[model samples]
Target: MSDLKKEAESLHKAATALRKVSHHTIKPLHEFKAESDDLGALGKLGSLLGATEDIREGMHTLAKLTKQLDEEWQAEAKLMGDVSDAFDLLDILLAAAAQAKKG
Candidate 1:
C-alpha cells in the first residue's frame, strides 16, 4: 500500500478513537438526578415533592449550561483545526511548486 493510504488509514483509526473518547467524555447532555432516599417514612409527601421538583429544575439548568459550553468548545476546536489545515496546505503547495520547477 502507498504511504498516503497508510497515513489515511492511521488517521481514520485515530479519529475513530478520538470520536469514541469524545462521545464518552461528554456523557449524555440530559438532566439526571439522584433518587429520593428521603422519600421513605422520613418526610411529608408535599415536602418531598417540592424537594424533588427543586432538584429536577437544578439539574435541568446545569445540563443546559453544560451543553452550551461543550458546543462553544467544539466550535473553537474546529476553528483551530481549520487554521492548522490552512498552514499544512501551504507546505503542500510549496512542495508542488518545487516539483514543477524540477520538471
Candidate 2:
C-alpha cells in the first residue's frame, strides 16, 4: 500500500541520517583515543568505542531485517510496530552517544 511505502521511505531516511551522524560522532572519539597517552582514559574510551560500534551494528542489522520482510509481512501492522520499536531504541542509543561526545 501507499502508506506502507511511505513508512518504509521514512525508515530508510532515518537510517541514513543515523548512519551519517554516528560516523561523524564516532570518528573523533577514535582519533582522540589513538592520540591519548592516559591509560585510564584510554580504558574508558575503549569501552565507549565498543558500545558505539555495537549500536552501529545493531542499527545496520535492524535495517537489513526490515528490508528482508516480504511484502505481505511488511503490510502487517505488527511488523511496522516492531520496526518502530527498534528505531526508538536506536534513537536512544544515538542520543546517549551524542551526549557522551558532548561531555
Candidate 3:
C-alpha cells in the first residue's frame, strides 16, 4: 500500500510538471495567434501563409495533447477519491462489526 501511494505521489508530481509545461506551451501559441492575426493581411503575399498553416497545425496538436493530459489528471483524481472512499467504507464496517461484538 505504501508503495502504491508512493507511485501515485510520483505520478501526481509528474502530472503537475506536465500541467505547468502544458500551460507554458499554450502561452507561446497564444502569442503566435496574436501575431498571426496581426499578419493576416500579409498572408495573402503567400510567404506568411505557410507559416500560418504550420502554426495552426502546431496549435491543434498542442491543444489536443493538453486536453488529453487534463482528462488523465481528472481520471487520476477520481480514482484516488474512490480509493479513499473505499477505505472510509471499510473503516465504518469495521467499527460496526466491533460494536456488534461488544453488544
Candidate 4:
C-alpha cells in the first residue's frame, strides 16, 4: 500500500476506536442524568441531580466543540497528531466528570 493509504487507514482506525471510547464515556452520564431526574422530582437528591444536569450540559458543550475541532482539523490537516491527543484528553475529562457525578 502507498504510504498515504497506510496513514489514512491508521487514522481511520484510530478515529473509530476513539469514537467507541467517547460513546462509552458519555453514555453513562446521560443515563445518570435520566435517573437523577426521576429521583430529583421527589425533592430528594435535588442538589446531586442538579449537579449531574450541569455536568451533562458541559458534556454536550464539549461534544459540540469536539465536532467543530474535528471539522477544522479535517479542513486543515496541520497538527493532526494533536487533534487526536486533544480528543483523548477531552474523553478523559468527560470520563472523570461522569465518574464524579456517578459517585
Candidate 5:
C-alpha cells in the first residue's frame, strides 16, 4: 500500500480502538458519580467527608469539557468531511456522560 493508505489505515484502527474503549473509559466516571451521589445523600454526614462536593463538581466540569470537546471535534470532522462511525460512537459516549452528570 502507499504510505498515505498505510497511515490512513493506522489512524482508522486507532480511532476504532479508541471508540471501542470509550465506554470502558467513561464507565468508571459514571460509577464514581453514582457512588458520590449516594454519599452526598447522607446530608450533614456527607459533608464531613470534606471535598465530596468538590469531587462531584470536578466530575461535572469533566462532563462539560467532554461535551465541548465532542462538539468541537464533530464540527471539525464535518468541515473536513471526515466523520466516521468511530467518532460518532465517541459523541454518543460523551453525550451519555453529560446526561449522567445531570441525572
Candidate 6:
C-alpha cells in the first residue's frame, strides 16, 4: 500500500481509539457533581459529544478503506501495463528475427 493509505489507516485507528476512550472512559463534569434545572441539558450534551466522536471515527475509517482500495487498484493497473509492454516488445523482436531468416 502507498504511504498515504497507510497513514490514513493509522489515523483512522487513532480516531477509533478516541471514540472508545470517550465512550467507556471519558466522564462529564456533570457525572461528578451539581444538578441544575438544566441537568437534562448536560446529559444531552454528553450524548451529543459521544455521538459526534463515534461518527467522526467512522468517517475516518471509511476514508482510509477507500484510499487503500484505490491504491490496490492502481497497482494492478500498473502491472497490467507492464505486461502489455513486454508483449509488444516480444512481438517486434520475433518479427525482426523471422524477416532476417527469410534470406
- Clash pairs, candidate 5, are none
Q: Per-residue lDDT tens digits of candidate 4, residues 16-94?
A: 5544554554576556545644544535464755665665566567666765755564444434445655655666676
Q: Give every collision pair in model 1.
A: none
Compare candidates 1 and 6 on lDDT and give the better one: 1
Best by lDDT: 3
Per-residue lDDT, model 3, residue 88, is 57
Q: What C-alpha lDDT, on a 0 to 100 scale, does residue 92 get in candidate 4?
A: 67
Q: Per-residue error at 26 for model 5, in Å?
A: 3.8
- In candidate 1, stretches whose alpha carbon ends up further than 4 angstroms from where it belongs are 1-22, 25-28, 31-49, 94-103
Q: What is the lDDT of residue 94 in candidate 5?
A: 69
Instruction: Give a tens-digit lDDT track for model 2, residues 19-101.
Output: 44444535655554444433344366657667645545555665445444433343554455557666666666767888999
Off by over 4 Å in 2: 38-103
Error of 1 at 38 (Å): 13
Highest TM-score: which candidate? Answer: 3
| Cα lDDT of model 1 by residue, 48-87, tens digit | 5677556556766776676677666566555555554555
TM-score on alpha carbons, each prediction: 0.49, 0.32, 0.51, 0.33, 0.46, 0.48
Candidate 6's residue-wise lDDT over 1-103, tens digit each? 4343444455445444433443442244234322322235446665776764555455556555655665565565555555545555666676778889996
Q: Which is better, 2 or 5, measured by lDDT?
A: 5
Q: Over 4 Å off in model 5, which ranges?
A: 40-52, 63-103
Residue 76 C-alpha lDDT in model 6: 56
Expressed as tens digits, the lDDT of each residue in 1-103 for candidate 5 is: 3344444455566555544554554677667656755554667765786866787777778766775665565455444334344455566676788899999
Question: Candidates sorted by lDDT, descending order?
Answer: 3, 5, 4, 1, 2, 6
Tell me the spans in candidate 6 whose CA falls farther than 4 Å from its real position.
Answer: 1-49
